[model samples]
Target chain A: MVESRRRSGRLASVPTSRNVKVSAGLVALFVVVVAAVAILVGGGDDGSDAPSERASSTTTTATSETSADAATLPPVVTDDPRLLGAPGSSGVTFTEFLDFECEGCRAAYPAVEELRKAYAGRVTFNIRYFPLPGHQNSRPAAIAVEAASQQGKLEEMYRRMFETQAEWGEKRESQAGTFRGFAEDLGLDMKRYDAAVADPATLRRVESDFAAGSALGVQGTPTFFVNERRIDPRSVDDLRNEIDAAIAGS
Target chain B: MTAAPAGTSSDAGVRRLGLVLLLAGILGLAASAELAIEKFRLLEDPLYVPPCTLGGAVDCGSVMTSDQASAFGFPNPFLGLAGFAGVLVAGLAVASGARPGRWFWLVVQAGMAFAVVFVHWLIFQGLYRVGALCPFCIAVWVATIPAFWYVTLHNLQDVAARPSRLGAVARIARENHGIVLTVWLLLVAALLVERFWAPWDSVFA
Candidate 1:
């Protein structure tokens, strides 16, 4: 019995007033620390980073350097899909690793489109497939786009993929059929399209881009590179500013 | 202090276990609150990034948006808020010389058992399904494991009168409980390392 154990001093004695105060103080300290952590680190994932929009407009130091380690940057591969401007068009080489199923990429589309219009001949825009594993239909969609590329509808199919991303992005299952429909609408030869989508080589093609992006520390989709420098800008303005700076510097 | 069970025995080991649980509960509660706050912020503003998400290796957003974040039809951190509060209170009581009865110990056992199981399930989801580790959730996992371990060991110590078959196990639970906890935690850490080997190794490299 517990009573006997208590009498025999086999149990911890009730703390004295001082010890009680210490325990209470410790609890209070823990409460304060917990509150502090909640208040300090409670922002969503992007909270950890400085607000790039504010940082860029206010301080020059924020956007000065980006992944300066050139070794980690992806090489300007010659055969990968090209957009806006061809490879080595003029001054700056603008490469983006984008995921069709990623919302960030969808949002960046308009800005990138505008950028293409603004700096048509001055910059070479290259888009690479970096279908994140988490996006349900991104990989299949990437393969579909690449397949369409073989049929000379690369630009049109690429735009269509972004335009129709909402139809398939984040779905629980693959929407390869919807993508196939897109290919059909684009007038890609159904046989070639079917063969490309079904082939290991097409998937491997996408995988190669992903591997290249992975090497360059591309953690998320919509990763932009201005002449092999990582650019995580907040707005189209920031992106344009960087491009303009790159153009001017070149 | 007033609720100390009559004729109760609170030994040094139980006191230490109580303190450990108390601290773990507070830590778990903090992580839970931070996660909950970040989740709500994300709902309000889709572009918001959680502070715990430092880089690709530690991203709460990817993990939070996953289906596993709401396994019980509600956010898991909501469960943590309620569960860790209970743990905090129970731990404080135990530390303050309250020797719990059988029913109380059973309740603690149930809570801790559920926590341990849920932690493992979340670990699986984080590694394989969600494909990202939320730093705050990982902190919660770390706190919950020790809370469960110490509580279960203390509960076993409390029972004292086990069946002949369980007697040896109880003795070991009491005598070598720290080792048991350490090994169990090491197993969890090993799983995490194995799951994120490339990214984890890259950090060191």
Candidate 2:
């Protein structure tokens, strides 16, 4: 069997002329593929990037683009217990504007957790909710997490969101049941959990963070403001390095 | 060049497909790496946009941030990295005239099938749910589809190995695979145009 296979393989090595029909066919396919790539890559902007009547609409409502540049950002979500690592007196502050249901924020959650651990007491890590309109469940999820904060389990719910993100992150509708399940798992008072999630004030708190994030020129999810300076780091290492630099400089 | 033997033509066909896969695999590998790296970079600094992002509808950022980008609870590009590397190696082996038994072809069939299906799922998600196109993922999509198609064609050509009904089915498909693939791709393209009609029209407007 092996010998016959070797013989079949050896036959393939001999020089042979290419088939014109197949060549032409492949070339045609190549042209078509090239066209597809052009259309795929060069056209069709997504929700944030698409320029249309929509962008013009955003320009009118989203005045947050200008005030976000300078490093003197007002404290995001002040009076909230969503602070971890270091007291408010700590000068090296790491502020992240996040959507609870945003996949990018989920991806960054572990890294943020790491930053909190490594810089414990030396850096202030404050998380602010900024549920994006595109995510169907983000607002509800933020309210749940915020409501958890009221019961002194804010950090627990923040971690819970990322841990269970796959369950409800990109769904077309709200997974209030799943979040209620999470609250149950956390052993929260069911009555308060339901009440907090239903409260108009809870919704307003999440909205306020969104407003603050928008004012900071945060166009996307998981935007981090370190020491009032907007910083974009691509990985956990990149984030740690940035934090390290900020702490060292401070 | 002299006319090659009848049997040799099929070998040349396999060689051509292998060469195509090799090129696509290498290019896809590069693109996937660029995408994953640039994504990490963008995460670190939102201001640093990838060149491929291009902004507007061609935004890699929008697509990458979508839940579908990490469908399996991890970045999809990591899958591309492994899958394209395997394709590149397989292409090199085929081009070097390594004739294998039925098992190798079956494995190729399975791998390509998985890749093509996953790519299409991603494509649908990008167009409908994610509402953006990820350039690197599309490169993998094109490569995986053809690789799967040709491998399917190659497997069917062996009449003895195929079941009686499948043998006839394969013979029919072998002759018409190109047209079938073209139609399939056209349907996908049509969906994209339809799904993004508003933005597409806005471009010209």
Candidate 3:
């Protein structure tokens, strides 16, 4: 068998004109096999969980334009421990689901803050957690944020987390230690911050936020619902337009 | 081992090149199929973000679920599979020693042109609409860039004809190193712009 295979291999290198076709065929077959293997193995596990972490990020965007009639949909129950935004108001309520470890979420932080400042009383903002599983520091980051909430420093923790997302995203020499440093920067009690992180209730709150996001059909982090209406903004202008429309609708 | 006539020798070369392109097409087909399956799985669970999900800035599930994922009602990746299949069949036929005429190659080149535009659309959607990146989808895009270029190169007998867009755009494809380099450079430029410049503009704006 080995000799026969070797003979065929030798034939491939021959100057015979027909070998061109044969060689191409063989190469084509090799490419097909390689591609098949790549698709099969490289496809791998999706690892979606509460937060989707699909490795393939380039995809066609689904249309997120919402009809003005979403107001008729069932009112959002803000009293749920998971609901971070205050509910029952008639004006535009912007609820954003975020993951602290997510870079996109961090990028949107300033934009969201700007929207908040611009809309102030016109738009009531609420934040929910949708920690992606791939982010090792995300759950801890959420816990730290909640701990800061306990100390009336939730907004500071939120801003600080976004500002320093890149630092923690890279392999921080020590995660817990690094988060503690954040706590110090935010002027929270170091011991209490540590305790809150370890606290099961705080963790539960974060987990509950994930559940709420899922229940609301929030598939990924940094998703926002303006006035309970799903709005997909392709640019800052697009987001501004959506907010403007929602505000005008009220 | 006698040498054939010049016409026959060149034809043989064409056949060999066709086979190489067929192999690329098959790989593209397989890649597209896998992407489609993964996208379907995400539809079912909604929360199942693949490893490609980096964060809020770049999420695989977010990009996949966007309207841009299915410009043709089906997952665009599957369209890639069909397109690649057409390319593979034509290439394999040519490699099998069938000429398949200029029309066949023309059609294949046209399909690839549409594919180039489609991929650009997806990139724009990711950068603008979703504001995230899907890593595997990007792999598909990378693989496609080569496949499209090679197919175009093969059809244009001389690689030098790429910048002209006359050969492949019409009936014959010119084959030369210049065309190959141009396509390669264009792909690289697109990726660089998307990676560096696009995001900065989006954020700052």
Candidate 4:
């Protein structure tokens, strides 16, 4: 009777052991699933939000500006090969990665030009073509600008590109006449400039610019870098403060 | 042999379902929190792309900037936050011994269904049209799927716990849930094919 009772007790405990093991297995599975989901949701392997990092860094930088002395003058624009200056000698650089055919890029021109006049030689601005292939007319517009660049009338063509963007051909064939018209307006040697557009070197340069912009995380046109730092021109005093800081730092 | 009564086992299952639904609600709430941060980032940098930057395979900026991301004239994240909040509140209420009415459970069922359909539209836009992925948005999407699945399963089980319409709904749900999840998985597979395996020639065309 004693042996039989012992055997029965062991048999009963088997179910309890099995139940414990199964529950433990389930808990482990749940933990694994939750951890996997956490890792996936955190985005980068570094597990931090990249966008907010950029924004917070900018915000902190902006807030720090109030401490600087107002009496100290900022730097004046230097005629460096890398720097493209506005009329006012502003020492800040406005580096724009732009697509000629983007409506937003076109819309931003007046604001950009206004900044140029407002800050003048205090700000140096450079434009890089970022022709997104999705927009049919953008690549041709970029090529046209390259041809104009060959003729040493790049700025004139850049301005006209934005001015007549709405009117210009979004197609390859129609862009040829538009290119000729721009060359005539800029008083360039039309034949040579047209040949430059077809040159492999010119096309390669535009492609290189696009690649560089992509590497810099320029997702869309009208991305601006002020004094080698990214800044949104839309914020009140954002461009001004950054330009001032860049001037002081220089 | 002391077998627990049938009613007791059924109650245990109901309790378990309640726990899972509550957990899913928490996940949804977490997703919405991240989404709110993304919306603020968008304000700071209109050109800001969400970090879907795994490769040319997934570019977040493309999708986030599209019209679909702001379907209601505001960012979709805001809507997600509100919706998830309601779910969290309802789940909490259910857990705290507040017995929801039939209409309340029905509303929950409809909301889950709506979420499943909306996520399908978003996945399509990301894959075929927008041609990019937002990492956080994808997180929300992933969380939403399981939340919907668990909620639907729980609702049917709850119906089964009751006598009225229990047999009919359980049979219908059991038959359809497999078909629904299978279709969802296939659609996602098709999107992945279009994005990764499709030739450049066919894709751009």
Candidate with the greatest lDDT versus the true structure: 1
**Model 3 chain B worst lDDT window (10 residues):** B1-10
Ten consecutive residues with minimal summed lDDT in candidate 2 chain A? A52-61
Query: Against the true chain A, what TM-score does chain A of candidate 4 give?
Result: 0.62
Q: What DockQ would candidate 1 receive versus the native complex?
A: 0.06
Ranked by lDDT from best down, the candidates are: 1, 2, 3, 4
lDDT over C-alpha atoms for residue A80 of model 4: 24
Per-residue accuracy of model 4 over A126-169 as CA lDDT, tens digit each: 77777775566677778888888766677788888889876763
Considering the two chains of model 4, state its CAPRI-style docking category: incorrect
What does candidate 2's lDDT look like per residue over A188-217, in tens digits? 988998999999999998888887778777
Q: Which of candidates 1 and 4 is the stronger one according to DockQ?
A: 4
Per-residue alpha-carbon lDDT of model 2 for B1-205, expressed as tens digits? 1111222225656665577668768977887898789768766654345666543455676676665778899888898899889888888888777766779879988988888888888887787666766577777777777688777777666662456876666655555555556666666766765565545444443
CAPRI-style docking class of model 2 based on DockQ:
incorrect
TM-score of 1: 0.60
Q: How accurate is candidate 1 locally (lDDT)?
A: 0.69
TM-score head-to-head 1 vs 3, winner: 1
- C-alpha TM-score for every candidate: 0.60, 0.65, 0.48, 0.55
Candidate 3's residue-wise lDDT over A165-217, tens digit each? 77786343447677788889877888888888888999998887776556565
**Model 4 CA deviation exceeding 4 Å by range:** A1-86, A90-93, A101-118, A141-246, B1-9, B47-60, B154-205
For candidate 2, what TM-score does chain B get against the true chain B?
0.86
